[model samples]
Target: MPDPMKVIETHWNSTPVPIDAIIRDIGLPLSYEPMADNISGYIERTDGSYRIVVNSLHPETRQRFTAAHELGHYIYHRDLLGDGVGDNRAYRTEGTNRPNANIRPIHERQANSFAANVLMPRHRLTDVTDESTAALAVRFNVSQQAMAIRLGRAG
Candidate 1:
């Protein structure tokens, strides 16, 4: 399988990462569904194809991040998903302030990293003039926290 970041870069080939277009190009259908506040999104394979459904109640940024996260799973861990996957299963996004448990599964961590890399590609950050992480987050259309994590990892 290809590296998730490389796949995203090849598919998007632009700044701000046109995620919707990438999804369309990849033939992964997306839909919005109302879910619990803690739930972010999920992916499922049916008839040899995949579909992603994100929680509509979340903010747009969260929704976008969730979509990217699910895409990460679709790209990286498709084989692990037996039939369907969701927040109730092994795939789930962080909910709220939970104390450092140091128990986050590896797949979740990978998906988060994949999402961050896709949304805030390191090449784009290198060319950024503004030093503010907030500004970069806005430019990348991701949460400030996500940007901060990506900056830390990239630097």
Candidate 2:
């Protein structure tokens, strides 16, 4: 199996802020335009560049998560898997899917985990005041569910 940590380390080293730096470092301005009917996000890697197409129709938080998730695919899994990586084809469960289901397919799960970790690294989220998921979410700019998962994984 490929080392997921190495993938994350590579992305971390290549980026200064990891999330936003990936855009500016490659000279791509962040555009939050609604993609046509089909496109979710796109990265033009020909010149080692990126252009993410987000659906402004969605909630701001949803779009932010999508952008971060797409960024995870770009940083960690794109070259390894080749083209068309920005397509969010992998399954995401609402409530019934087992928690592990969120992290089964190796690449997709890793990308999700990478996005979560990059956006909310341990060093940044170490405040750990009282263990409330909602509190942590406010601290990290992530969803309450994401904070809960990270806290669970940390233990």
Candidate 3:
């Protein structure tokens, strides 16, 4: 698998981090469809490659976060994926589907961190010390909460 940080760095020419381009570079196919209200998205290895499916009903920011989170599993916890990482609306990985993967909460936190890093690369923020969290979130195309968490982490 490609080093995700390197991938993000190479493709960080724009705001929002252009995750679709990253997905293409990672060779993971993506799709969006309506799903249960409780579900956010999932990433699975089908045949020999990874696939990301996002909830069509979710907000674009959420879909972006979901895709990034799944990429998180692909990067940090590939060996832990029995089937794949399925996340719920609260950003926690969980499922009752038969053959569900036994992923731990630590991985969930890692993935969340990965998503935040991907969406809000810290290097991009170094030049700015006057932006509000909401403004930064808008500039980065992430939720204010996500940016707040990121800024908190950065501090």
Candidate 4:
């Protein structure tokens, strides 16, 4: 299978990652629901189709990240779904920190990494001459913190 970053680049083919279009292209319907503030999003297979619902209460950046994170679950952990996968506070607030034992930390970490990579691709970072995380964040339509994390991990 292609890695998440490659999938985002080759399949999506746009800068700042047109995540909504990609979701739709992949045949996953996305909706914004008024979920608990701490809940980012969830994905599930229903009626032979997949749906992704993000917390509408969150900021646009958070919602975008949540969508990408949930997409990661759909791409990498579909077999692990049980009543669907719900990501809560720890997964969202903690950048790279692994979640506690009760949660599937590995899956959470993978999804987070996937979200980061998809949102701010490494190749795109290299093409940037500004070298400002904030500017890059604006360019990528992601939060500054998320951009920093992506820069730190990028080659």
lDDT of 1: 0.70
TM-scores for all candidates: the values are 0.79, 0.61, 0.89, 0.81
Model 1 has a clash total of 0
After aligning candidate 3 to the native by TM-score, how far in Å is the CA of 148 from where it should be? 1.2
Model 3 bad stretches (over 4 Å): 1-3, 95-101, 153-155
Ranking by TM-score: 3, 4, 1, 2
Which regions of candidate 2 are displaced past 4 Å?
1-18, 35-48, 89-104, 127-131, 153-155
Please report how far candidate 1 places residue 43 from its true position, in Å. 0.6
Q: Which stretches of candidate 4 lie over 4 Å from their true place?
A: 1-7, 10-13, 92-103, 127-129, 153-155
- lDDT (10s digit) by residue, model 3, range 1-155: 67666777898868768988898787788899898988998888899777988899988888899889988888888787766767888767665242244677788888888887788887888866687888888988888888888888444
Kindly provide the TM-score of model 4 when superposed on the true structure, using C-alpha atoms. Answer: 0.81
Candidate lDDT values, in order: 0.70, 0.54, 0.81, 0.74
Reference-based TM-score, model 3: 0.89
lDDT of 2 by residue, 38-149 (tens): 3444443444554555656665544556666766666675555333344432323222112222233676687677667776676655667666777667655666766778
lDDT ranking of the models? 3, 4, 1, 2
Model 4: lDDT equals 0.74
- lDDT (0-100) at residue 43 of candidate 3? 83
Q: Which candidate gets the maximum TM-score versus the true structure?
A: 3
